[model samples]
Target: MDTPPRVPGLGTFLDKNTGTPKPPTPQLVTVASRLLLLAAVVQVVASVIAVVYAASPARLDAIQLQIDAMTGSTPSLAMMRNLGILTVVISGIATITAYVLFALFLAKGRSWARVAAGVLALLTVMQLLGITLPEGLTTVAQIVLGAVAVGLCYLPGPNHFFATVKAARS
Candidate 1:
């Protein structure tokens, strides 16, 4: 039996059970990937700033004084400083990893990408909650960015993309 040639104006409806047309990349997924990348970059910058803040003599002195006032006995300022530095390094690496994975998901259309992004966003929210800012600007920014990151994954475009991918896969 011979198959008729597809018409030029007609759209290609791929067989649900076979590999066919290239899957479309949704705008929301693209936005999500970019957001993750931006987050990673910001995290790196913030981490560097954190390390500088932790190592500054003035900051250390302030911390030491606070500790003395609280406990009435001096704690090792060096230990506190080292711990702060360690936190900065660890957080930066985590941010970078999340960014890389999210970007990969966008490029390769992986289903697990959103899961990783969600986890990272959750961690970021938790971290923001624990920090005390001198003003409300940082808190506001954190809330907005975190919301956008999570929101992107749930947007209609990405949701459709995932659905199509799932249907095609099965």
Candidate 2:
């Protein structure tokens, strides 16, 4: 097959079959991919913190208080501790797993990953807002990181990457 001549200043050559120029991956996409991965790491750390907190004595006390208030009876400390640990471990692992998968897909230029990340970030922010005040520094930081990650996904570079990939696939 004969190679098409490169277009001046465009850096891409015209496809002889389609008569269209296929642009290369933009630098912005590369930056956005790295940011997405960083965001995933941040989320994983937050998840670990959550699990730790849930397994802590403070969390057990909170659960005990709730059970007492709801049932007019106090549960055994061991029971509350076991339940809290189980709940936290399972939910935290699942959340971290999902975030990692989303990050991987986003880095790979998948449009759906961006959408999922955006949705998750929005939900997290909304949930945080529902709280009367910032719970702690960690909570605040997690919210900020989540918001930043979502914003990065919507930025021109990442947005264009997702759009271009989708268009090419179609």
lDDT of each candidate versus the true structure = 0.67, 0.63
lDDT of 2 by residue, 77-156 (tens): 78777776777677656656666777666665676766777676666665454453423444455556555666777777
- Estimate the Cα RMSD of every predicted model relative to the unseen true structure: 10.1, 9.6
Cand. 1 TM to true fold: 0.67
lDDT of candidate 1? 0.67
Output the lDDT of residue 95, model 2: 59
Model 1 misplaced regions, further than 4 Å: 1-22, 62-76, 130-143
Poorest 10 consecutive residues by lDDT, candidate 2: 9-18
Off by over 4 Å in 2: 1-25, 70-75, 127-135
Query: Could you tell me the lDDT of residue 157 within candidate 2?
Result: 70
Pairs in steric clash, model 1? none
Candidate 1 residue lDDT tens string, 1-170: 99889775332223344555547777777777777677666666666767787799987998788777875566688887888788878967877776676766644455566766776667666665557664323434544554686577777777778777666655
lDDT of 2: 0.63
